[model samples]
Target chain A: MPTISFDGQEITFEPGQTIIEAAMASDLYIPHLCWHPDFPPHGSCKLCSVKVNGRICSACTFPAAEGQEVVSSSEEVRQLRLRLTQMLFVEGNHFCPSCEKSGQCELQAMGYYLGMTDNHYPHFFPVRDIDASHPHVLLDRDRCIFCELCVRASRADGKNVFELAGRGIHTRLVVDSPSGKLGDSNLDVNDRAAHICPVGAIVVKETAFRIPIGQRKYDRRTIAEVSVAEEAPLLRKRYEQKED
Target chain B: MSKKKIRIATTSLAGCFGCHMSFMDIDERLLDLAEIADFDRSPLSDIKHCEQCDIGIVEGGVCNAENVEVLREFRNHCKILVAIGACAINGGIPALRNRCDLGDCLEEAFLTGIGVTDPKVPGDPELPLLLDKVHPVHEVVKIDYSLPGCPPSADTIWAALTALIEGNAPQLPYELIHYD
Candidate 1:
């Protein structure tokens, strides 16, 4: 194990741990969109951009090295993080009130965490499709942030049912079927990829409002609160295995 | 003598009046709000015309010509106009109709819906004409502020109104600033 410096604090990490993983292992929360624990880092969303050795890089993909200095909470980095989150908001039709995932969406909670009061960027309002072809899943194309979480999850889980198609600005989520529909795809309700969507883009149909507002995730406590709550156990284990 | 309480006006356009209900959710706090502000041209007050109020709180989207007219009148009268709730800030649920053709939507509801008997589109000169698309209030007129919630919690309404009454920007806590 080697130690890396994150935001002026020393943190220990195993070999080959990304800065984000190391930070997470030590209970440090970094704002992220595409990075998920269940899948490999795709680094699509740059919301986790951090200053590594004074050079900006995505913490989720950048490897943590011994004595490496990582900065995530500086004034410049904070502004960039805010702008990135705002861009995501404007890019999607994230009418939080109308969405079933409102109270629980990590993206929305990120907006709160970053203190984004207004979408400084212009809203794209792209008229995307809401695919209700699946009996269980609702595919709201408008809410898709293009994080490729579904793609990564399906690939990792060996379902290989979802993929991000198109090129550049024309990019969009696609189902792996001739009919181009979720029902035609082999996706089952039990797949980890089925539950990997951070936003309301993909969700279980008929389960809307199952968890009432104010009683939902990120409602009682912020995403940061939940992130830190995962840190205590790791800290205790490290203390027990501490080497003189 | 102290200046008159901040005159406040409110109205519902194409919404379900849920935001107004949330406003009423203030419960006993409504009494406190009354001390610092007076309702004018609001459903609660039942006033017919807006009287150059200090603040105007609008809920819902602009779905018809009548909504546009009412929204313009509010802008003409109030010193500040705030779009409250999701419908006011954005079209919310009603804007889902933007996906459908207006004529086809009308036909589906009146001409070809289930359990329809002798159905007519209810065309009348007195009836407000539908706009081609449902629009958030900002699309029609300027809004001084926006309170983002489905039917913003009662606490949110109270906090926003109190801030407006105190001549400051309405800053809500993250817990209160939900879209749904």
Candidate 2:
């Protein structure tokens, strides 16, 4: 067992756990989007960036070490997270009012948690395609944040149906099929990839606005509260199961 | 001695006036607000032009040349400009047009749309020129504060306004701050 100081609070972690995993096990949220318990660390979204011993590092990828001091809730880290959230908003067409994933979306919840009052940047307003070809699911590339949760999930499922192509600002999610469409790919409705999107990019069909505006997840509680109460328990259980 | 009332002005540019309706949703609280503030130019007052005011609350995106002109003029007249609602903050639904070509949008609306008898784009001199894209108010002018929501709840608007009137920064709680 190793101990690390997270935001001035001493927390314990196993030898191989990342900062995020260690934080979750202790019920301390680091405000992450790409680091889910079921998947390996992708480290794409930098919302989980924390200052480890005065050096900035992605908590999802940074290993928790003994005697290390990690600052997650400091003003500097909070401002950085806010700016990253704003950048994510402007980089895509995140029209939350019109988006189906408005309430349940991790990005939207992160924006709320960061107290984002405005976009604070000019919107890129890039043209993105929407693939409604899939009978059970819809692919709206406008909302993708390149977190690659779906990419990992599909690969873990042995589907390899989703992949990232292009580079820099031109990078986009592409299907494995020749037609470059979700319907033409081997992605099934029941696949983990279909339900793993942190944003509204890939959503099940006929499930839009299933929950009312004020009643949805992240509507009543803040992301930090929800993450600790709902997600931390599951993550802790998984860790305990692994140990047994 | 009586306190000097704060002057507030508001306007809508390219929105559905839903935000304005939300403001009116303040309901009986409007009477409480009237004691501390006076309306200079607003939909409630029916004033066409803005006057020098302590706060200028604008709700809408900049879609046409007239919107830009109005926003600039409004920005110049107020000490603090608050962009209220999703339209004023992020262009809202009108920004969906940003993905499409302006020419294509006009042609589809007037010329190629269903049941179009006389198909021609209007070029009247009186009409304001449409901008290439719908932009949030901050893109056109500097906004002092932005309250995000489709139409921010009456309580949220009340909280921000009262705080602004008292010369304090708006500290919206987690429940009050929502994009939708």
Candidate 3:
């Protein structure tokens, strides 16, 4: 197994492993949206852009070859991410206070992680529609970042329920049915796509705030702390070091 | 001769006054702050008019003609105008009404609303005219800085204040900058 040096630590990985996957395995977080372990990387959300050998690339798709130097924690990267977060913030009506996914949203957590103190850019506040036609799932296009997690999730599981439509800045998520609504699609409350949305765009109806604010997953521990998949080994190493 | 104490003014326009309460959550730190800063025009002091100040904190979204006038006055008097909390930053929960027509909202609330005994929308001249839409502070006037929590945490407000006081760039840890 060849190793790549990320930030400064060497992370060993098998061939074809992306920087993001290896880093996650070693409990190193690279701020990202539109990425999940269960599917291929879409790279739609550029929040995971990192400097690999001084070239910017998506960590979730960038392969970790032998001796690859990746910088994920530089001030420059933070600034870029902050601006990107601002773009997302003003591009749509992500009025966080009124949103159901305020506490648990990955996009909101990413903004905090990057220290986006304010939305510096003038807001677009584009008008969007919310589709509550689904019996169980709610589709609030205003909150959607077009991550396509739902689209990819549906494809992976053969549901074919969600897809991306339009182009450029007009790009948006669409349902694969005769009517352009979730209710016409095959998605259900139990669908994996329904649960994979990183934002509040797709949510279970009548379940808003079921889990109290401060008790939500990202609230208890930061998205970075919770994102570390290899916490056990990292913790055990620290524990053994304490005994020494 | 003594150093001039920093003057701070805050106002809530169309919000729930949660930001002001959260500001108070600084607790005993207010004692330390008292040595360096004084309230010029704030709900805490019940001041009626904003005077010349070092910092102006505008809470809540601007939703009426009077709110616009007060916000402009704050801008004219204060050296730095900071929009605190979500309402001040991006209209917060109040901006939800931006989706519907103002006439429809008024009609729903005062005319055809449930449990209403009389359906008369108040038409008094004393009432301030409503703006066409609820607007974040920056949309109405220049905001030097903004803190974008639903009600920015006490520590977040403290960090911004002390950073301005100490004359440094305000930086916050990951946990402090929440949108909710």
Candidate 4:
């Protein structure tokens, strides 16, 4: 077993593991939005940025090296995360008070974790369309963070139902169907992509606000606490099975 | 000798007044707050215009020309201005109209809306003109602090007010901070 210094704490990691993966295995959480354990790292969100030997790198894609010093919670890294979160808020129509994902949203939780009290930048307030064509799932593009979790999940499921279209600032999520609608696509309500959105973008119809406010996930506890408690065991089990 | 009391003023524009209600939710703590602070131009005092004050707490977004004027007045008069609740921080619900054309919105509400008696948009000169878009307070003027929530919990308001009165930056715990 090789060891790395993560924020001055010694943690052991197995070879071929990314810094975020190793951190997860050790019950540590590096704040992230796009990186999911089930999918390959996308490094799109950049929320998991950490300093590796004084150089900033996306922890989800950066390989953990032996004896490397990883600074994840420094003032510089925290400020970077704060600005990134603020950018995400201003870049989208993230009216959290009216959003169904207010409490459970990973982005909102990340804002709370970063102590973000205001939208530091002027909002873009981009005009976006909502795809309620699907009977079961609704695609509210207004809330999409372009994390591409759904894109990867649908691909992993061999559906390829979602894709990112357009260029920088104009980038958007589009359905892979003839009519360009979620209803016309092959995405069933049970698809991993349907429920994989970290935000309220692709929510199952008739399930909005099912969990009352203040009782939803990330409400009572911070994202760091909830993420570590729920993900650490799953990662540990997966690694254990891999060894077997 | 008595210490000089901190003068605080508050106002609501384009909001439901829920944030002001939450401020009142501080309940008996208002007694404690009154001991150290004097209400200047608040809903409680019924003062129409803001006077020179130590703190100005604004609740709502800039939806119409009047909101911009009121916010600017607070910014000019107060030593520190705090934007309270989601509306003031990011144009909470009223901003939903940002995606739609203002003419469409007004026509829908005044002309095409269901069960309308007289379909006519009001054109009174006294009515404040609507802006093209709803904007958070900071977009119009500098805000020294922001306490975010739908109507930030009563405890959150209390904590922030006390901290500001004491000349200390607010340090809200995890449980106290929420967007909804």
User: Looking at candidate 3, what is the lDDT of residue B25?
Assistant: 97
Report fnat for all candidates as fractions from 0 to 1: 0.33, 0.82, 0.62, 0.82
User: For residues A1-244, could you state the per-residue lDDT of candidate 4 as single tens digits?
Assistant: 9999998999999999999999999889999999888888899899999999999999999999999999999899999999999999999999887788779999999999999999899999999889999999999999999999999999988999999999899999999999999999999999999999999999998887889876899989989999899878877887888899
Model 3 regions lying over 4 Å from their true place: A230-244, B107-129
State which candidate has the highest DockQ. Answer: 2
Count of backbone collisions within predicted model 2 = 0
Say which prediction, candidate 2 or candidate 3, comes out ahead on TM-score: 2
List DockQ for all candidates: 0.34, 0.87, 0.53, 0.85
DockQ score of the complex predicted as candidate 2: 0.87
Alpha-carbon runs more than 4 Å astray in model 4? none
In order of TM-score, best first, we have 2, 4, 3, 1
Q: Local distance difference test, per candidate?
A: 0.84, 0.93, 0.85, 0.93
State the TM-score for model 2.
Answer: 0.98
Q: C-alpha displacement of A100 in model 1, angstroms?
A: 3.6
Would you list the rank order by DockQ, best first? 2, 4, 3, 1
Q: Residue A102 in candidate 1 has what lDDT?
A: 83
Interface RMSD of 4: 0.7
